[model samples]
Target: NGVMNLSIKDIQGEMLIVSQFTLQAKTAKGNRPSYIKAAKPDISVPLYEAFCKSMETHLEKEVKTGVFGADMQVALINDGPVTIWMDSKEKDY
Candidate 1:
């Protein structure tokens, strides 16, 4: 539904996605990140786009995002209905 305007990569191995969808991605080699071998636009891109669509729908709002193909740290914070409204008064922190 959408295209990644950015890129995603792991310089080290410290990146920890709680869902770990990439863990199960198929590859030519054995169990590894298989990033290089990962034919992204062929597979991951569509899925990523679909995820974006479903995600925005589920949230019922336009989720702010970065260019997926761009090198950046990706961490999804699953905050369920944690809506906060700001005002001139400090009624709620």
Candidate 2:
């Protein structure tokens, strides 16, 4: 589900949504292509745990997440920040 679907209110301040793919990768092949299709508790359990914890630490608030599965239902109310992008380098500009 996209962030657009998530209903977030800045009752305190803005909310930041971080996306990390290290937990989802295909090391079985030479190149590390995304293996998100292969869902295994052994691999995802720790990753998801650390992810939620880190977010709470940084934001000092509960970081919500979607269920891990194809049949998961996602719905959100349209608010603001209705956009997206991709950042290649971590340039501190």
Candidate 3:
């Protein structure tokens, strides 16, 4: 049961997808983080919508999402403590 054999479509649970651009912040130069690597709103907005739509299509259900380009407060109680960070640019992450 611990095997990685499930996805959002296979799991019976609620899915909440939020657009977080700050995840691309670069802090190499100074104390203040730079968001230069993050995609611009013009490009990211449509991509975010398309991504959400794709998720809905795959899961066969409506997926909940936060408003784009809006200040949001998110609070979550993570039932599972496991965390995995993935980067597309780097291999074997």
Q: Write the per-residue lDDT of candidate 3 for residues 1-93, one digit (tens) a residue.
A: 855677657677677889998888999998999999899999999999999999888888899999997899988887578678866685662
Among all windows of ten consecutive residues in candidate 1, which has the lowest summed lDDT?
10-19
Give the higher-TM-score candidate: 1 or 2. 2
Ranking by lDDT: 3, 2, 1
Give the alpha carbon lDDT tens digit for every residue of 4-46 in model 1.
3322222211222122345445666676555554545668667
Candidate 3, poorest ten consecutive residues by summed lDDT: 2-11
In angstroms, give how far residue 78 of model 2 lies from its true place.
Answer: 3.7
The TM-score ranking, best first, is 3, 2, 1
Regions more than 4 Å wrong, model 2: 1-39, 85-93
lDDT of each: 0.50, 0.59, 0.86
What tens digits encode model 2's per-residue C-alpha lDDT throughout 70-89? 34444565456556566776
The numbered model that scores best in lDDT is 3
Tell me how far the alpha carbon of residue 73 in candidate 3 is from the true structure, in angstroms, after superposition: 0.9
